[model samples]
Target: MPTNVSNLPPVRRWVPAPVTKEDIDWADLTFVDLAKAKTPEGRAEQVRLARDATHRQGFFYVINHGLDKAIVDRMIDIAALAFDDVSEEEKIRYRARIKETGEYLGYKLPQYWHIANGVKDRIEHYNFPRDVSRREHPNVLRPFLPEVQRIVEFTHRGVLNEVQKLLSLGLELPENTLPDLHPFDETNHSFWRFMLYNPRSQEEEDKTDNVWMKGHADHTSFTAIWSQPVTALQIKDWDGQWRYVRHVENALVVNCGDTTEYLSGGYYKSAVHRVIKPPSDQDGYRRLGLYYFHYMADDVRIAPLLDSPVVQREGVNKFIVGVPPVQETWRKNRASTYGVTQLERAEDGTEYEVVNGVRVTHYN
Candidate 1:
């Protein structure tokens, strides 16, 4: 039977009091302005801030890490055009399919009562995989129009670069986890673009009793989100209080994923989050967002960070670095033993599937 939203955990009645510029945690979550990571001391401070925030709140707001604002605006504009101007027929063409080989692009809707029953998410999105060459999968390059195309490409590249920097700071490995190349290359990692539309009509808003995304953690190592100035985004704080993450101009919200949680051996947390249906007044405008899910190279093994005292306290031992050779063994054993999975869903609603025991998820 389909799950109804009403039966899910009661929408926490407590919404965070509005956040102002003054409330922003500059020391822990704001953007860094330097051309590169700071000196040893600065680097340590940044890492400490990120680690503490992840361990406690599982979410943080980022600024000044060097993403181009023009690019962000262009991407947001293109996303609006794709959803607003493109014909429904054209958008449907990019829908994902689930086959014996694996899941591919197509549109999916939530089944009634699905969330409460542990059914898959009921949302529609466009899936573009970064692992497959654009030539091999031309659909990956398809956008509703030419301008949209340019914006998507640029946004993909820009965000990937930022992701590399984040990974470098979080991981203490000598070699860089993100390879040098065009930001959105499919050869080295997986990248995807997801455009979401939540309902706005009065009928839809009233149906919130049976609708909205359920609580869940992302499966990738980390995710970068550019949310439209809408009201649906919410995060669970350390105190188990639900706080609304209102959209801030030119800011990207970063959160750890399940993979990061496992590799950090619980030193960092994969934040629990969900989407709620907006109130009637705000529903008319569709919610727009672009997410870049970052992954380690195909062979990266997720052992705890050795230098951190937290890992020692958690009993995580040092292990060889690089992707595990037996991907299936690693996935099953990791999830069962450590309680997390590597494969995850992008904002685009595309599932990153393992192929032939290889971790084929995007690393951007």
Candidate 2:
């Protein structure tokens, strides 16, 4: 049986050691300025930063990025408008539906979402993907204001382009690591936008419940997040300390994803994180954030970093080395929340079940 939210242990608080100037490894940091990354030295530095930060903290902040401030503001404006303009009935129109077997659309509730059993996430989010063609089995028509739709498409393509450039640099691959054409087959690539809201209400604030996201790691290649003034994101340091990641205007938070860990052969870390519900009016304010998840193409093989043979050998002994040939691990991770059949639908619209740890997909 799943554990009750209230029964979960309280989050332990630990003071973090202050980050000093000397401790700051400039080599491991990626500033948002791409022009700076254009020169040979600049490109070298960017790759170093990407590799080091992923191996060390699995997260970093980017400033001076090319994303337009105007576009970002407009996106946030649309989010607020959606919350305000869409009637409760209209919002419910997009609520996911289950097919004949009675599985609600994909992962929904915090308590029931894919992940290990834990308390529900305190955050509420709106999900949107970049490209939707009829060819895609899971593609469903979603309601969006015309202006919002335009912005979503523009931002999605622009951000993806930038991400591809960064990936190419870090991987030392050809400029078209992710070609103009889709890198992964339609079945593999995953991209989505998540508009998260952290609202404060008396009922929510006063509840003595542990209804918040528990510590977990993402299942993708990387996540790019941009936020407005509200601050609710925090990172757990290696020393078991929680550091509040203050949202600087126009900055993007970049973090490593599960695929990156696999590709790096475990050289880069896929850090665990959680969302904490802000205290009600803790200084007379609430928080809001927008997150973009960049997933690896489904079929991309993940392998450990080539340089660290010793650690790779150790990892093999520990059963953490080498890329698993199939998506069994990924499927198993989501099964608890999405159920075998529902996860299959979301992945490829086929009925799949794991019998004896083998995923058997049934196609009509």
Give a tens-digit lDDT track for model 2, residues 47-136.
677556666788777665565665555455544443444455544655434233232222222223322222223344445444433222
Off by over 4 Å in 2: 1-32, 97-122, 132-188, 198-211, 279-286, 303-364
lDDT by residue (tens digit), candidate 1, 1-364: 1122334222112112232333321223334323334566765666556546777766776665455565555555544444445566665554443332233333332332233323333455554445333423233234333433443444345544544454445555432443332234333344455556555344443444433665556656667787456666667667665567767677778777766676666667778776776544564555667776555544555556566555667666333245433322343333332211345667755334453243333211
Q: Any runs in candidate 1 off by more than 4 Å, and if so which? A: 1-36, 39-41, 99-113, 116-122, 131-187, 200-211, 279-281, 302-310, 317-364
Model 2: number of backbone collisions: 6
Each prediction's Cα lDDT score?
0.50, 0.47
Taking all chains together, the TM-score of candidate 2 against the true structure is 0.65
TM-score of each: 0.65, 0.65
- The stretch of ten residues in a row with the least summed lDDT in candidate 1 is 8-17
Indicate the TM-score of model 1.
0.65
| Per-residue lDDT value at 307 in model 1 | 60
Worst ten in a row by lDDT for model 2: 16-25
